[model samples]
Target: MLLFLLSCFSFIIVFKSSNLYEMVSFLTPKFWIQLFLRPVLKNHASFELSKLDDFEMSLLDLHDLALDQILEQLSPAELCSLAGVCTYLRSKCRSNDMWEKHMEKKWGRIIGNAALREWHWYMANNNKRKYSISGGNNGGSFYSICSWWPLNLVFRPKLQRKSEIKGDLPPDSIMAWYLSLETGEFWFPAQVYNRENGHDGFMLSCYDAKISYNLKTDTFQARYSPHGRRTIEENISWSRLRTPPIDTPPYNLHISDCLDDLRPGDHFEIQWRRNKAYPYGWWYGVIGHLESCSVNEDHCICHDSETVIMEFNQYAPESRWRRKKVSRKDHREEGNEADGFYGGIRKLYSKQEISMWKSLWPTKVLN
Candidate 1:
């Protein structure tokens, strides 16, 4: 009995020396509760609640909100701010479904589908349809239009005063999305598509629209020419590598830049620009959707200039092109020299114009 008592005393001393009781405390619920809740609870009170004004309170009311709820409840400006907070929020903010929902809200289902289809066709041809759309222009995703654009835009609801024309160009067409290509900034270029009834004089007037992404300039500029670059031999001549004719007329023209209003969901506008000061008071117009800059190279796609090719036909080369031309006398013995002449005529006219006949045409077209 005394030996057992001595053993018990030795065990107690070893346990006390090792502090095993302290270690076991970690297994208790109180210790776990302290460890688990302390960081969140202690930091919670220190959070600056007073800084959250009424604006943020209403937004936070959407805490734990679903995608649809956030899009439907918040304004675009608000959603932009929220998405900018973190990666998790950014991912949730740029959902295509949200854009489509807004699309449907702004335009009817039929119009929305038509617009989306048009956008799809544009992007598909330009190799961009596979990427996200809304985020591409909203300064969120890759090659965005709004990010890094150099501009100080003031959003005015009503016209405080008439827009002072900035350049000698005509009054501004509606400003579509613009870009700062020199700096990879996006701006609102003028858009001018209108409805007018005519058949002979102006029935078929075509407005040419193009968007160029210039890496050096880091800006994207959109242009609209109701009649396209004028055919003054000067313009065409200068377009080529060769020097233009001395008689080439100067292309003295003007454009407009005026956009002062901003609506909640207004993507861009389509308006008109009349160059009354021109030689004939011409009207230049265009319609544009969006512009995306290349992340690596200087490139962009204008919606109107793109086309989707559903099918491409291929053909194999033929050796018939290698046949030697026969002399008139040498062909007479073969009987149909006249036939050879006509055949040569047809082939020369048709095949000579083919892409392979580069040698026959002047390397310098304008010069």
Candidate 2:
């Protein structure tokens, strides 16, 4: 009986231990948490996979219209880079329709009819040379309308005004102006200098001048409104420059007899050999339309009869003017500088020569 009871107690203890293990397994925190989160985690993973698949499909199988819409937003440089990626892209990029659209958008207003004709010629012969839609050329056969040098304007102060002043007056200033081919506007870089009384002097502070270039005449016309401050005076200061009356004749007409090869639209600049104040420096006057040119046996006379003159007091700060060595080639070729005023003529065909003369001036483009 004692052996039977001992065996029965051992069996009971074994049964209780097995029951406790089953209860613990059902109540475990880790087991229940994992069971709840598995379905949610699997659904999230599937959604992410679907999103990735859609992205890949959109890029690889986009419609032509969609692709074109995307490409339209890219710049010329960006389009060129994209064209190199594949054969399909290359064909799209080389489409004449696309090029014409780009040209019209970028330079339609800036280029005149003559320039547009030139552009059409370039496109027709595109196979012979590399052309860019943004008016840049990769080869020698093409010239872009946007690449031409802009017309420049110079203003010199009149010395007589300062001489007539009684009290302490502000120093005189010089201005170099340029016309924007795109906007048909006149602008110049603002210059800052210290006044004699330690005040700030802002020269050419106003920019209300409108400019237009006539392709047929090769002449520039500018009109200044009565708006904007022209000077840094305490009171309103108006611009001293006055546009010549419209009735003025062309400068080339006067000298056409002397120069048999005179062409319409040629650029003319007035230059004096000697500066009135400083005899050593080159005195350059405003560039104007060449109304007439007359050459006699003794002297050559070219007049800018239609030129507008800006009269102001002459101010030559020590830092304003610098002496540069006169080229022996220029001096010998041009002959002795005329005493009063000389016309420096440049033809459109001689672009290199024109650039060489323009390089002498410090100011080119203000904007």
Candidate 3:
């Protein structure tokens, strides 16, 4: 018992050492809880919680109300440490409300329905694999279990992972998912601005990719789709990425809601693609008046007309890439194979969005 007590004392020192703890996550709260229990812990861990005697400087020594307040202020690492002390603390730490806050603070910007669906697939597949390895009960087929999950998500009000609940932790819990992301085990689908590692061709635009965190470098890796070729980019920072602001898929045109507000010199992004086989990418453009419209500011009736001209100044004057016209009242897919196709148009509202595009202006005009 003396040796156990001494070991606990030494562990408290290591736990308090922030640098050491981060360097080795395995030395975290879970590790501390299991350190004393050894081979017998799993069976008796919950029972032993009642037997623990709080000592000096231990948060465990505080009243439940006071401890609860302190827990609210603690960061993720601190919560993890406190959780391993006892079953009651573990319950509080693993609560969905707490994990959800952390998730939003860090990942809410870039994670949307698609990312959530992908996470579900990851959890279901992982559970299925574990079941196969362990000879699961009932022995259901993988396809039968997860085939309709994405569709079912639409009608369901809340996400439930009852099937994935097993062992000490539920794989489907928000806490588990957050930890998976923190550890870089999960690569979620999201969009990155100026992708292709800031290639000039993709500047002022965003593209879809499967992105994952890199703990060592505090960066990210993005895996692009393989229509004809596949590529992966590394060391991408957070500022370059964002959740798709709109739900429209890359191939489908984003239904324009702000077209009625288009005016001369107003900035906008129109979906454009080289061919039907390619996905639509948001290209920066400006709304202009028709040749027949009066140049006088007061006499301009361009916005009221059926046709709205979109100009890309980055292209040479004689280049086919310079200008295109779409119906203001009803504009669908417009363009041919020679000049590429143009889809829906979205008026740029935020000054920041406009500034970001201006900053990426090509040094030379496109032919």
Compare the candidates by TM-score and give the number of the best one: 3
Write the residue-wise lDDT of candidate 2 on 301-336 in tens digits.
323222322111122323222111122122211224
Q: Answer with 1 or 2, whichever has the higher TM-score.
A: 2
**Candidate number of the best lDDT:** 3
Per-residue C-alpha lDDT of model 3 across residues 1-367, encoded as one tens digit per residue: 9985786566567556634345233323333334444556447645654333321233345576655655666676655544443445566777786678888998887789989989999988788432111121222221122222232222232434423311244676787777677657788988877777767567667777889887667788998766524468898888888776677888888888887889989999889877788887788889888899886799998888878888988878897778888887788898888878889888888898888788778788777
By TM-score, the candidates rank as 3, 2, 1
User: Which stretches of model 2 miss by more than 4 angstroms?
Assistant: 1-53, 58-60, 85-87, 96-127, 130-367
Q: For residues 242-284, what per-residue lDDT tens digits would candidate 1 score against the true structure?
A: 1111111112222212122211111211111233221211221
What is the lDDT for 367 in model 1? 10
- Each model's number of backbone clashes? 24, 13, 0
Worst 10-residue stretch by lDDT in candidate 2? 169-178
